[model samples]
Target: MFARLIRPLGLCLILALPALVFRLSGIESDPLILLAVFGTGVVSASFVLAWAAEAAQVDISGGLAIAILAVIAVLPEYAVDLYFAFTAGSRPEYVAYAAANMTGSNRLLLGLGWSLVVLIALAVAKRRTGKSIRALTLDSGHRVELGFLAIASVIAFAIPVSAQIHVALGVGLLAFFGFYLWKVSRGDTEEPDLVGPAATIGALPRRQRRVLVVSLFIGSALVILACAEPFADALIETGAQLGIDEFLLVQWLAPLASEAPEFIIAILFALRGNGAAAIGMLISAKVNQWTLLVGSLPVAYLLGGGGVALHLDGRQVEEFLLTATQTLLGIAALLALRFPRWAAWTLLGLFAVQFVFPGQEARYVLSGVYAALALGAFVYHRRHLLPTLAAPFQDHPDEQAAKAAEQESRTAP
Candidate 1:
């Protein structure tokens, strides 16, 4: 009893640290900053609790994590963009900035995060003998769904940047939502089960689920908003003082800090041997950012003013292109279906190359390269794609088999 109580208390403390840091970061204490700090503490603790509850159930779903992380991709935009949109009399610029960030974040996740996972799997190949590297098979449902997403992603990219993104984004989001519902309703039986004692574990109680969901929603909102103010402000002030580009500080450093939750959560899931969920959460985050987050910003800006515009100079354009290209590579790498050591190296290579590249044309070229790689990989794995897509649906039976097999293995030994 004491142990259980102590664990939760410790986690609460851990989550609150960010908010505390935010409060202490600046000498000038804005009242809103104070409010954000308090709110963040509450929200972070709630998300931790929700995560714990899900882990306790031994569930490996990625939907919740994806949704939560996606919120962060937009949080920074909303926090700063909204302020400028309302006050600067340049609502269009605010919308443009928000859209750019969302799009950029999505590409980064796909290009960097996905590629890293593939490469990491190879480096850690011998770490676990029980898990299979070729475990990701898409079922027909998933295939159809992913096909839609692929098309949507492509179409979205093709649309001239100046055009309204609302319709495209709305359609893409609806498709994803529909796909998610179908996946969930099919039950989480799409993979081989983990070896464990089934009788001792029980289904999650509704009350606990409610507590977790509510807490996470409220806590995340408050925590992120609170952290954003200080993080963004610090980046601007410190960068200026240090003779660094203020935009660089806010754009890059701030996001890395804000993305800490997703990073921590993904690592936790990976450690638990739920690679699919871990990877899926990151993917979902990209999808939401690319579609919903980017889409909503323009609408918000328009409401704030009659027109929205974000002046993209050459440097900003280059960064945006680099982001998109990276994402294309990551997505394609995942579709490869085999986790080779080289895959990981390539992912890191692509990410590193883009990291240093300084022009939009260069990024655009790399993105094309990424697309070509994906196409080739898909063709190479054509025979296995069906089985891979169907694997999630078949995981239920495999899970039961693994459980039964484990029991027998233990008995025999």
Candidate 2:
């Protein structure tokens, strides 16, 4: 077991080495070099985080671990984005950077990350079974996530329509997030069937396993905190030097780096034929990003001496509209608790269209298309709407089982 652990563990450390040296050395480096060093470090640490999260289910409560691990992506991205928001209080120009990072990460999680999980899971299923499964069914218990995500998605449209992120709005979003954690905690615990490095770590004795998990979580978070700022700055500077739009770079590249862990971890689960867990994790991530991450931006700005609201310009407003609409479409797609191939392709295709037509007009057009499609989807799954709304507050199957067992035991003569 010790020998088996060496390769995966060593690779993560090695990948992180250059960034650690660069960060500690304090020697000024080229923007491109900094991007590579810090980017690699983030990716490497993300892998470690992935392993720790998978192994965490053994130590943490079952459904609760998913909720906690979903925030794994939030740590670095929030650090980078909040830096921009906090700075925007004084600089003001940094407000656009904050918006770009938030919008980009949200869109990327649903577009690329969610689609890839489904597509790859289908491909793996074809090889294993000699037939492709077109739709991946989610566990019924996951309605808790879908339910909260749906509420968040509906609430998200207010931001673009208002062209502002107010403290009240942020608090509202945070309320939903709080309820999400509450629902997850109320669910009964179950042991996850883990594999790969996570399995190796899970095999450890209880105390040792816990110590290792805590160590990895702390170590990776520190590495991420140290690297996120440098990585973001490097990407922006590199974009300027290369004559690329810094908005595009910050929107896409920064998120690509910070979102790496969640994406990689989801892909791993998908490859293992656990498509439900894979996509479910991404959905949880989207929920947290939409709620916790988005909600925190204005609060951070205010703390940095900005006013009570984070205002968005016209372009940023359009971007938020596009992101919110896309989120609504995503919720509609999963209203039936099944992700189909056509929906996967539709999301990926529309997301790719953004790069081809990068203009304010295109954003409005895409938002319209997304909104229409989402409307259709909701209509088709209309029956599930009320149940989805109530799902978070309802008892989970495991919880019901536990309750019934306890009741019967107490009534025994």
Query: Of the candidates shown, which would achieve the greatest TM-score relative to the real structure?
Result: 2
lDDT of 2 by residue, 1-413 (tens): 66888898899899998888898988688888889899999888877887887888887875666677767646878888988899888878889999999999999999999999999999899999999788888877777788888888888889988999998999888887887887787776666868789899999999989999899989988888888778888888888888999999999988888788778778888999989888988888888998999889999999999999999999899999999999989988887678989999999999999999999899999999999999998887676666777777777433443344355456647
**Considering only N, C-alpha and C atoms within 3 Å, which residue pairs clash in candidate 2?**
none
Task: Single out the weakest 10-residue window by summed lDDT for candidate 1.
Answer: 193-202
Question: How do the residues 202-277 of candidate 1 rate in per-residue lDDT, one tens digit apiece?
Answer: 1335565445445544565555555554544454456556687555544544444445445555555555656555
RMSD of each: 8.4, 6.0
Each model's lDDT: 0.49, 0.85
Error of 1 at 191 (Å): 11
C-alpha-based local distance difference test score of model 1: 0.49
> Candidate 2: which stretches are off by over 4 Å?
396-413
Task: Report the poorest 10 consecutive residues by lDDT, candidate 2.
Answer: 396-405
